[model samples]
Target: MGLGAGRPAATRGVLARVSTAVVVAGVLGLAGACAGGGGGGEGGQGRLAVGLLLPGGGASRFGQFDRPLIEQRVEELCPRCPAVAVAATPDPAVQRQQLESMITRGVDVLIIAAIDPKLLRPSVEAAHRAGIPVVAYDRLAQGPVAGYVTFDGAEVGRLQAEALLQAMAARGKGEQIVMMNGATSDPNAGWFKEGSLAVLKGTAVKIGKSYDTVGWRPENAFVNMRGAVAALGGGSIDGVLAANDSLAGAVISALNATEVRPLPPVTGQDADLAAVQRIVRGEQYMTVYKPFKPAADAAVDMAVALGQGRPVGSIATRTVDSATTEDIPSVLLPSVAVTVGNIKDTVVKDGMYTIDQVCPPRLRSACDKAGLTG
Candidate 1:
């Protein structure tokens, strides 16, 4: 089950980076004002206790970028505040428990990338009743969230679908492509799928098979891809719209296993190092790069403001409505489409990943051929 579908939302303010000086002064001033323990909300206690919860951590972009970046920004803004409490898990029940425990510990504000948005509603509500402000990060939680931050998901899907169609141009009309979508439990998955369908519908590309990958797991994607191959036949499938780099790798693996000669182009997101290498090696077509710094900085600003009992409208550039909430203040960031041609210009230039990380020794020749090493 998914949250009730709501109005289409875009992070219309992607170009406007977070104004750190203004946000920092606002937070610190508010904290100082509340130093006498005035009624400034949950953070009126002088120093706020911020808790962060992410869906996944180990080796995922959350750990590689979001976590450290968020922590660093929080420290820079609130040098005297207690260190942000952090937890990561792919399990919704466990995440709920973690959130509840944070609430019990009296954290003033929370930033959560929910594993299951619907299941976390009760926890979010409970926090609301307990006077803690919840900031929805990455995934929107279904409750009274104070602020939201994430990339433009629809743009991500549109970019992937467009890249796929361009790659499959040789097939001309009626190209059969499989849609390897994300977990149905995630709202962003629905948005991505809808965005891609909007583009693919007008084209001659036919969606041969679509799978809502369980838990966004690579192994589940691999199993589904194998099933797709057996059912659709390897020769008939022209492209695969794998939702992220992990799934794209799985899709490519399944195709390799079935020995699909001259493998069809596969689309992915999250410019993971492995995905960049795969793009250079000509195994995958492209991935979406959503710069983590701006998103993290914005999230921290929102968290700090909410923690100190300040209005996030100053920090939020636009508004988004989740299934249960309407006109929630939000910061929507933009994403870039990355391919072999712009690997250096996009990811490397942005410092998301160094050339050595993307190239590695095994991919030296491929990197050279892609003009990344040369």
Candidate 2:
């Protein structure tokens, strides 16, 4: 359900004072420092100086949902004290540079989704060494991240596993499926796999083949799916447990290329529009709808709380630890399983997407059949 991003490092208020002359170089195209007053650009002081970094390149859900929703919520909470700076780069090195830049610019708090959680450990340590607060966004940051907000990734896997099981039941296939897990680099991937395996362990189900997706890359999924088909025979693949919507899309594309007309049940997450549409058409069996608003809102609140030197415990409902801390403040958001039956109740209700946008001409009939009326 999530990925990593990066951020740079700089001192807090004290370092900002001496680094005033270097704010330009410090922001790294982000924005100027606010230590000298009126230098923070469109977003300023008394406001929360927050740094937001997303894991992928342009055209990702991080920018679409994580960045704006986070910025919006921050503004709503502290109109005067909310200043969010966003930087997204696909390269982990570039992300590391971004994280350092944010810290150098003196943001009160840093919120990140690591491009590589373990690799970013040094950066997280740098943030802590500088006394900067970090909130692990969506995935664990592995350092001394102060707060965390994310869905139970294990739950994400469990949902997909359960959905795959049900889909298998519908097809009257014996309990066996191929697993399409995410990249091994991401901590969340491991959690999701663990959860899914937990469900499949003693069940009647048997895993035919499984691949740990590289970078959670769709291409990798395609390659893996192709291999699965080659090994098991196209018709033998009873179900696919794709980790996310993107991977699910790849699996479906491969199955289509192989000319398996009526594809097996495939499970996905993120409740992406395409996945939802696939479900409506019966190509994909299910997706996990994580109401992103609440997660975004929680991040916003955590960022603001860190910015204002306020206690984040009020907004946090749970606690989790990474390598550095025993218990970091956290918000473990719930995830809902979205099949053809309830896109309206989850994402549409959460305003993640509009019914009209989702019910395009190609999908209009399917949408109607699924009860997603305009």
Candidate 3:
């Protein structure tokens, strides 16, 4: 959620380049697929209509990584597929409206990253009533959805917890750590919370207090951090378990506002550039680095396959049942943990970010220290 959220221009440029490559991949695969289906039109042979909905638009990763990548994959898997994407940022009402629109449009399949997993149930149920399939994207959207596609969210939390504990031990101080989790409305947030708690069960570190961050907003995290600081005394916190990089930023900012030198270790996710820089400066401990390419590509492939009336069973690794349905074809991807020491191996080598962006003049020294720039 954190990678390049503010700069739309740079994010759009990155998407433009990557989308072009995705298109090329799509055309080659799609043409071959249709040829094998006989010299008929895409739909005349096996055309499929698919619908997609995502939770947010503010994150650069969504438009830059998920949208075009999924579109291209659909093209590759289903030459004659028609796909529509309707999504918004943190607006459950808008998402509900979009779901209804998708249903009214009579799409054959639905893929959704639910804005509110619970509130979106009625629409998912309606899709089932109409005989359409649903694939829960990312957060295991609730209702009669067919399948679920996402990385191991619990593992993401575990990584952050492990890294924070490691950082705490390095200080050799038995101080308390504060947990700032994501929104309660999100299933992944709960999964992440459970994972982190599992890791910290027997540690010497005592929990001072925890808060469920709403909207995953930097401001919300900031306010929460301020509260924690006031309640526990500014310097009492040994570490912060910020659910993601955005929260980590807020935590660091709040801590710095108190005139604290060398901020306590904080855990984060999404591997946002700012967080990466923080890691370089030794302000944040770690973040979860999810390769958006694979996650994006897998969703695209599944959506496209659904659109083509082809068997997604050929591609998907497993089948999951949501509250409303079961046995929907899906793909679950893998993720990695990012720290200053391995930025080059994860985001850099994957071409998610260029050295220029990460190693700006101000961050040059930090990059060198982190082995990010030669």
Candidate 4:
């Protein structure tokens, strides 16, 4: 039986009454219907139609963890609910179309990790017009998004920058570093760069070169890193502040291609499996582990609640203002900096990945040295 099937008729009756009151109040337009009357019948007992639009699958996290975690949580919360998920390949146009399709298909709520928030505003507004609440997941999308769930983006950059500075400081002062930021279109990229600059500014580290990677693609990062290497002179760069693990991997690859001896510290986020392996092997410096479970759980909770015409105040503890919207309910989770020292405590302890999963055959020796037992 479905989740709603287990509920007593009396509970359904109460929900029907509340839904009627909500409709009379005319709070959320079509969204109010989604919460109350749109699902099954007069009793408001039916499966929720949820649409999940992820930015891309190139980032291993999106496919390997986030999608599954969110789907599982949504099923647990609303067994009868069906979640339609799609990856946009980092194309804003494709994402917009996907959003439109979901809206037209009558999805009760949308969880979007926008490829380009600005470009998706019109689609988001369209969903709003249709009375479907949108929840901004990970990346904040403009328009009347009902709620947001993500880590403190600026702090992610601050953590990466601070760790890079510390690593570079060990070599001596007056270091020069390259900044490989995410795509310019991503608002989180600007926030990350701002936070990183806030720390990098007034410091001994010289910003030798910076590039806003197009599409946040590894290839773009590789090309940019190569250019930075050429401009700064090979092996002269001190460290790299890569926006995420993918970029960090590309930067590391570029450094390797240049045969830069003693590769400088490179900072990343997402704590991707490869990045974690790089850290164990002493190739990458550190990564910011933004625990996706909490974020995913929050998004699922918010989506289910909003789909059922319930309030999101309890789920969203804070409010954030976007370029197009203000006082948007948000749940910004904290992030942790992961190095070889705490691999066990962070990813392993949290069961994000087993030690064996992270410590592949090639990385076994390094894993053992890092005190990570399989």
Candidate 5:
């Protein structure tokens, strides 16, 4: 089921109206703050402070896109509002401390991409107690979050599985595949696995083995893939459903070590620079391109709204239920399946990456074949 599948229309309409009013009030307050040199009276006016706590730097997207985009958007929307960002490096304990620090320091709002949703519940609850609104970014952090922003995670999994199935069509029925899932702590990982299972289960493909990489670490994935190769026997595996590009890289590295001829097709996500290059070189099959701009923008919008003590119903169209929070306002963006054929149309055209950025000198020939050249 989708995030907001069962909400009544009447409630949605009411939330929309509330959101519109909040937005207007927020705008007026922003103007007042600027005029007064960053200080206002009611409705959370003045210089707003937003805290951005990311999971880690493991995934390239967090640093390459999410942080800068969110910071830039926060500046653009509320120039007086300053966003303070910190990376937790996938440690829930460290994230908890960071949350406590942010709360202690008195940030007006927080945007958290949790390392472990359940583990961070207490911290989230602490933030709530302090009257600081939390906006869950990319991951659905448990607890009382004011809002959430992420891509359709289940669709991401379905896209990867569907692409893998197509790539493995020649192998046909009874083909063995290994599932290299992300960290189990991440809710998105479960959603991805669920969506992929929806496509791969009961089909011609047989799940030879599945491993949830701890902390979504490439090194851990490397170890897991190596073990899978040793146990399943090299060249026996048909395809690999890598949760994202980082894991795909590790899986590919493992396959390379075994010297598997005609390497099996692998699926990935995040469209990381290295992953895109892998696709160009035919080392990886495909990736799910989640345009981060919209998601980041939505998070910033919601952060500003919440910081200003305004409703986010207009910004967050959908409502998602978490382990502790129900009907939480959310903005779930769409994702695109990117193959070598459309790298230019998806990432390049969107200006997420330039031709030169993705196409290196050594990859020129491959880029030409993929039509990624100037």
Candidate 6:
């Protein structure tokens, strides 16, 4: 979908200027709902039953950060809230079954980050039919989603593309970059791709090859990157715009395997620890750092309010439209561009990672050169 063409007027303003102050001010409004004893709920006389579903677990950002953050926020907001039942998988069929199971068990509210939004629509519809509100987390699942929370995908792409352009400029040889995007099933991937194209197309950059990595899998990315190398003749590939850190890692590995000397600049998202280390080692150009705390907090806030049979207007900073729904209440947080230059100021300062974590013993010299050390 185009960014601003059909969005609501209030949403357009948010799209125009999504800032930290605005996010804080908008989210603080949710506190009023919590102050009123978390409103009223139907789960065993005010104990809200929450269901949490993610696309991945174990080492993924959701496992390490989003889940814990959301769980903690739920506890702080509603001490009497039932322990949130959580499930995660990268398979759409499994995720759909999980949501259906939650609906059958009669959870008061569900927070889901769908592995494949389209495939999960029937389940989201089932939840709606069962009078259970589904709060779409990170990824905007189709159907009657009551609320949504995520970073601006377009802004993320813009940042990566702009950074790649700057890095490619240093080469002074060519302006051709391969685009390694996320799965087509992911709507955010399209947003990121469109956003990046908006920037790159306006410039002299020529896209040598572009592939949508299936399932956002590293193996898929490896194959695609290797093919791009073979097709474009490694030396002609000026840069790479891998959608996220996982794919970026694969792209780097493939390039190395192909013996592409003096690696071209690469861009990534999610600010994965390995990606950050790569940046320090001067192997990657930049990664988009989407602050997960605000997103998790907003999702939890929305879930609690929804479970209590309250409207999310108080919590949502803006409204968004999905293919199956329109004007869905949403909290779209801003993101930062992280590179070797501001690792400390962006990710480290936010406590997303400690200096010790990003600067390991083996990376001591690179860390020192990047000014990440004390």
- TM-score, each model? 0.88, 0.86, 0.83, 0.86, 0.87, 0.89
Global lDDT scores for all candidate models: 0.80, 0.75, 0.71, 0.78, 0.79, 0.81
lDDT of 4 by residue, 207-317 (tens): 999998887899999999999988898668989999999999999999999888789999999999889999999999999999888888898778777777777787887
Model 2: lDDT to the true structure:
0.75
What is the TM-score (0 to 1) of candidate 6? 0.89
Q: Give the RMSD in angstroms, all C-alphas superposed, for model 4.
A: 11.7
Can you write out model 5's per-residue Cα lDDT over 194-258, one digit (the tens) per residue?
Answer: 88999987887788889988878999999998898889986789999999999999999989987
RMSD to truth, every model: 8.6, 7.4, 8.8, 11.7, 9.1, 8.9
Task: Please give the range of 10 consecutive residues that has the lowest summed lDDT in model 3.
Answer: 1-10
**lDDT tens digits, residue span 47-105, model 2:** 34567777853467676677777766655554454355567766556676678877777
Question: What is the TM-score (0 to 1) of candidate 1?
Answer: 0.88
Worst 10 residues of 1 by lDDT: 20-29
State residue 209's C-alpha deviation in candidate 2, in Å.
Answer: 0.9
Residue-level lDDT of model 3, residues 207-299, one tens digit each, is 898998876778988888888888998678888999988899999999988766557889998888888878888888899998876776666
For residues 110-164, could you state the per-residue lDDT of candidate 6 as single tens digits?
8888777777888899999999898999888888999898898889999999899
Ranking by lDDT: 6, 1, 5, 4, 2, 3
Q: After superposition, how far is residue 79 of candidate 6 from its true place, in Å?
A: 3.4
Candidate 1 ranges beyond 4 A from true positions: 1-45, 170-174
TM-score leader: 6
Q: Residue 169 in candidate 4 has what lDDT?
A: 80
Q: What is the lDDT of residue 291 in candidate 5?
A: 92
Q: Which one wins by TM-score: 2 or 3?
A: 2
True-structure lDDT of candidate 3: 0.71
